[model samples]
Target: MRPHRCWRPAAGGWLGRRLLRPPGALPEPFFLGLCLRCGQCAQACPRSAIRIARWEHGLSTGTPYIAARETACDLCGGQAPACAAVCPTQALHLEPGEPVRMGTAVIDATRCLAHMGDICRSCFNACPLRGRAIVLEGALRPVVDPALCTGCGLCEEHCLVEPAAIHVEPLNP
Candidate 1:
């Protein structure tokens, strides 16, 4: 599991950041309306990816979200996502062809050892989308392909560097 570390947005954290939602989740408002805050998704997650929001999140308290840097959604292998399967309100959906669209990852090359002339493939190896989402460049540096990125945050979680060289930017809420 990835260790705890807070992500601070450019404008500061709580005021500017949005919570990362689970895969196939309805837009923020819609999901919130239908979600029963029952914690079923959290219980069903095999990877323990979903966490219920606490009081600090205001109206979102008890809502389900994926704190990707801490734990990322695995989409329950190739099967229907476990969280969505157990959600009685269907706040989360299942689309046959789309695997997921949690968010996209952006690499800070200054911190990336590979980009700094060291051989590293941590992000590439950790990406759930693998070859499609993260590719190795000529210098063996990992490059992200946004079109294929599922934003699972496995790359960020597996990063060997403290503060992680690569981090997942959450979807706009």
Candidate 2:
């Protein structure tokens, strides 16, 4: 069956992966339809993890997005996500204690220190789900379990590599 208009993947992702949205954001078209661009979500973020989309984002301009390399969502220390809490519309929604599956972190093994025979577990150590979302193999390489990953970007943020061996992909968008 043909995908519904609102349910189809956003065009941005057709060119490249979608930008990381704030935790609990609705699907792209639904979010764009409902979001008021009020900036409330960005303001509610304790870590200032949310940013207004720039003009370059085209249709997504003024929407709340997260740059994991700069800062990652902390889910307000496991409470309801602040961005979702402050959303006046259904653009975002997070129930208390719900894990934020914002995106999935993928590791570039070619660039990862551990995969190079060095010992680096920064991504594993920074994962909110600890051993569940990210794990270490016998060779000391960090592996991501997509099913369990919250995609909160902590691993990307904490990566010690210059370009970051791990990066979050907006899988849900």
Q: If scored against the real structure, what TM-score would every candidate get?
A: 0.87, 0.89
The worst-scoring run of ten residues by lDDT in candidate 1 lies at 3-12
Looking at model 2, how many pairs of residues clash?
Answer: 0
Model 2 per-residue lDDT tens digits across residues 66-148 = 88998998868878887888899969987766767888899999999999999888998988898889989884989999999
Per-residue lDDT of candidate 1, residues 1-173 (tens digit): 75225533322234446677887888777888899999988998999999887765656778888877778777688677888888898898876776788788889999999999998888888777788889988948899998888887889888878888888776646
Cα RMSDs of all predictions? 5.6, 5.2
Per-residue error for 165 in candidate 1, Å, reads: 1.9
Assess the local accuracy of residue 159 in candidate 2 as a C-alpha lDDT between 0 and 100: 96
Q: Model 2, which residues run further than 4 Å from truth? A: 1-10, 13-15
Most accurate candidate by lDDT: 2
Candidate 1 residue 89 C-alpha distance from true site, Å: 1.2
For model 1, what is the error of residue 159's alpha carbon versus the real structure, in angstroms, after optimal superposition? 0.9
